[model samples]
Target: MRIVITGGLGFIGLALCRRLLEAGHAVRLVDSLSPQIHGALPDVLAPEGAEVLRADVRRLGDHPEALADCDAVYHLAAETGTAQSMYRIEEYTDVNATGTAALLQALARAPRRPRKVVLASSRSVYGEGAYAAEGTGTIVQPGTRSKAQLEAGQWEPRGPRGEMLRPVPTPETLPFAPSSVYAATKAAQELLLLSAAEALGIEPVVFRFQNVYGEGQSLMNPYTGIISIFFNRARQGLEIPLYEDGLESRDFVHVADIVDALVAALQADVPPGLPMNLGSGEPTSVRMLANELLAASGFKASVRVSGQYRVGDIRHCYADLGRARDVLGYKPRVSLAQGLARFCAWAAQQPAYQDRLDAAAEELRRKGLGT
Candidate 1:
């Protein structure tokens, strides 16, 4: 199969490119290679015979048709950040939301179209997620977290009678209630790709990925990937900071497992339908992740549990990987501990870059995005 992948030069995209090449598929990659994601373009992005198309997903004349001569496309390009998205509203929307539209428009003008379109969606679309009330045993899915609630440092959602709610694994059936501009863009990407694919006589598959972390992820990008941020802090012997009482949780899926699902999506005999989650299905707290990364890297710095919470942040959300398991026959092979250990071993050999998380936070504060 000839495959075209947008964002195909980044961490996950490069891995997919390698795998597709190994499977005897000719590959072409479309990417802007933003400095934030890739500090500098590496000399080599893939095995020989793979082509790289240099273009921004939002820019015309070079996108969409980049998918020409391909059997399928894995749309993975986006501006990703939860807290930063609160401030960089226009950039996130332009890249993630309008970027998808550009691809569809490009497809509309093309003489030929890829038979299948696979979108890389995020789990953030399920804001607040499905929660079970402790007292009433009822399920509740709330909307956005108010600025008042965030200002008061009330991180978790509550029931009518003040009952504590437990985080439940959110499924695809739950209505979208994205809190941040980034999450909203992801939801919009899904809607746009699927709707446009249907109208254009193309098959579309949407994968709502969990927090994917592993080797090749940019350790210097402080605005995204908590694991990479912690790894950077550990490399510099700096303290890892935690927000929201250190209890906020996420389903941290290994990038390898994510690639596995992506590969499975190519071969699986499943119908194009609603978004399906690709995750480990196990929730790990922020503090726990920090501790694990530090320990994995053999760093002695203690994590700081700062009570300050970022605006547009969620308290707890994980994947309900049932649909992925059933439909794609997917299972996560690399455990968190195993994946972090591998990343640490590889990172120890690389130059430890400066940790810019504090600077990122300061930028957010200057823009009045976070408290």
Candidate 2:
């Protein structure tokens, strides 16, 4: 099979590319190597066995050959900064939403379209996720946290009658309630592929990924991936900042587990209709993550609960993996402790990068997206 992966040089994309190559499939990577994720003068080398296409995903129609004769297409290209997206609205929508359109157009124009189109979506589409209303225990999806509510330090999302809610595993049936530009664009990407794949006679598979962290994650991008940002700060003996009293949680799945699911999606017969959640089905608090990373890295950076918050931030959200398990036999094998150890080991050997957390936070604050 010949596979083309947009953003193929990205952290997850590179890992997926290597996995596909090892399976004896021809892999082609289409990536612009945007400076935000790859850094200026990126020193990245193409995966040994794969072909590389240097092109922006928004202009994919101009390079139709990248999609020609491909057995499958994995669309992973996007601008992925939740906080930054609140301000860089146009850039995020253009890259994530419009890029998908370009890919569809290119496929429509292709003499031979790929049979399978797999999209790497995000869990952010379920803003605040499913929660249990206090006392009644009814599962509910809460709305976005208001600025006033956040300013008042009311972190936990409340029910309509102002009842306190407890975070629960979010099932795919939950309706879309994206709170950020990044999440909105991801939802748009899902709709674009899902609605068009059938008309184009292509099978569509969407995976709503959680907080993916592993060895090759970019350490310099302070706006996304808390693990990398926290690790970089800890290595420099700087204090790790925790937002929203550090109790807010996320489902952190390792890149290896994510790759496993992606590979399974390729060979395994998945029912094409609905988007499936890909995660460890567990939630870890931000503070817990900080402590674990510090211990794993043998770093003694102090943690500070800054009470700071981002505008589009969710209180807590994790996946309900029932669909992925039944359909793809998917199971997350790497525990948070084990994955942290692996990440720390790999990150320690790499050349150190500057800690840009302060600058990134300032940028968010300047844009009135963070406090």
Candidate 3:
């Protein structure tokens, strides 16, 4: 099958390209190679025996040739900074929301449309995620935590009657409650693709991924990927900062597992237009993550929880993965311990990158998104 992957040069995209190519698929990678992810004047380290096209996802309409004769299209390009998205509203919307529109327009102009269009959605769309009232045991999808609540350090979401709530496995059934511009754009991308794909008689598969981390993730991009940022800081003997007392948790799925899920979606008979979550199905707190990563890196850097909190940050969220398991038979194989060790080993060989963590936080602070 002939496949085209947008943002194919990215960390996840490159991994997917390798797998598809190994399976004898004709793969073409389209990416803008943004300097934030790929260093300035990158060497274009794309996989061997695959076609590479330098193009922006928002302008894919102008390059219909990339989509022409494509059997499958994987939409994996987007601006993915949760805190930074609060301030860089236009850039996030233009790249993520408008980018999806352009992809659909390009498909509409294609000589032969693809059978499937898979989107890379996010768990952030389910802000605060699924929670349960402590006594009632009733599942609730809480709305965004207010600024006042965050200011007062009320970290967890509460029930309407002011009852305490506990985080649970967030399912696909939860409605969208985006907390940041980035999350909103991801929701927009999902809706646009799902609705338009049906109209075009194409299969739309959306996977809301949890926190994906592993080797090859961008170490210099401090605006996203907490694992990369933390690892980078630890390697450089810099302090690792944690926000909101460091109890907030995330489901950390490895990149290899993510790639496996993408391959499964292509071959498995997954129901069209139904969103499935791809994750490890286990919650790991930020504090636990910091300890594990620092130990794995063999770096001695102070870990600090400065009572700082970023707007649009969620208290807790992890994937249910029941739908994905039922539909695609997907199960993550890498444990957090193993994945962290692997990541640290690979990152150790790479050059120590400049820690941009402070600069990014200062940008958010100036914009009043962080405190």
* Global Cα lDDT for candidate 3: 0.91
The TM-score values for the models, in the order shown, are 0.96, 0.99, 0.99
What's the TM for model 3? 0.99
- Error of model 2, residue 234, in angstroms: 0.6
TM-score ranking, best first: 2, 3, 1
Q: Give me candidate 2's TM-score against the actual structure.
A: 0.99
Quote the lDDT for 127 in model 2.
82
Candidate 1 lDDT over 226-313, as tens digits, reads 8888888877778888887898898998888999889888977667676899888999999888888887888888788888778888
Q: Model-by-model lDDT, in order?
A: 0.85, 0.93, 0.91
Q: In model 1, which runs have C-alpha deviations exceeding 4 angstroms?
A: 40-44, 63-65
Query: Which residue pairs of candidate 2 clash?
Result: none
At residue 105, give the lDDT of candidate 1.
88
- lDDT per residue for candidate 3 within 131-188, as digits (tens), equals 9899899998878888898899988888988889998999999999999999999999
Residue-level lDDT of model 2, residues 1-371, one tens digit each, is 99999999999999999999999999999999999888999888878999999999999878877897999999999889999999889999999999999999999999999989999999999887999998999988989999999999999888989898998899999999999999999999999998898889999999999999999999899899999999999999999999989999999999999999999999777677689999999999999999999999999889999999999999999999999999899999999999999999999999889999999999888888888
| Clash pairs detected, candidate 3 | none
Among all windows of 10 consecutive residues in model 1, the one with the lowest summed lDDT is 40-49
The regions of model 3 sitting more than 4 angstroms off are none
